[model samples]
Target: MSTSFWILCHDLKGGGVIRKSGSIIKSIRQHTDAWINVHKLIPRDEERITEISNTRQRMDYYEKAISLREAEDVASLQEKLGRTLSKAEISRIGVSKLRLFLKELLRKRYMDSVPLIIPLLEKEYNNTTRKLNEINRELSTLDEVKLKEKGRAFHDLF
Candidate 1:
């Protein structure tokens, strides 16, 4: 890979966080040979993969999920409601983002308990990180897609 391509691919954040996933896909399809193969890459042991069985089964479930989503008329209602969902659900949500959000939230909620003079994450850093870690671990293995669907996109995370 070229230097620019390598840098973009290895952002080292564990996953991509660009604002426009669709745009990235379009760019790669138009300009590069770096298509992703989820089946080839995803580790099978990490989670359950329901046996789709056949096209009828796949189509039936997909249509059902789509209809349910239409009934709810919300972007991610299907995922939140435990209906069939797509990979965008997982990619848009991530462990690191959740941890960061929780960190800022705790600081905001307990501002008086935290020092104002010192930089954030400087004073009582260990304590805060410890609590966040506990929270993260406790919340681990949550349906990442569903939790992400619940998060607000009112402001761009990019």
Candidate 2:
């Protein structure tokens, strides 16, 4: 049977159904002849920012399809697919554990599509970190905040 027809027969209007469809989508390339590169389905751009935005949109769509919110193995899943895409509290967690969390998150989030999207995610992560550092640098240059922290003991150390 065609993948579309099979999906049509399955009632996928609800969140639960959508998740099931997602799991089926994951298993398709493995269990059957169906194989797809989500990257090819998406539009590409020359500019890195545009490319990142488009990739992120597609990622969001896939994320919705296989949302970990209702997974049967939910207990084993990490929070927010273990993605601290913007801000990772590195100081609060173990480095190896965080690495494991990221690895698992990527595995679950992208699965077979990781080859196409890993570079995008990596670039996006680097971009996010760069922008965050820029913001922090700008904040550090502010005289008011510096003055406010003058008397604090651990402010400089932390």
Candidate maximizing TM-score:
2
lDDT tens readout by residue for model 2, 44-153: 22111111221234545645655543342343334547743223443224332454466567768777787888899999999999999999999888897666778475
In angstroms, give how far residue 26 of model 1 lies from its true place. Answer: 35
Give candidate 2's whole-model lDDT. 0.47
Off by over 4 Å in 1: 1-77, 80-92, 114-158
TM of each candidate vs. truth: 0.17, 0.23
- Per-residue lDDT tens digits for candidate 1, residues 46-152, read 22212212123444465587666554543465656777556665433444235445756776878866566466557579789889999999788688777676675
Residue clash pairs of candidate 2:
none
The lDDT per prediction is 0.48, 0.47
lDDT of 1: 0.48
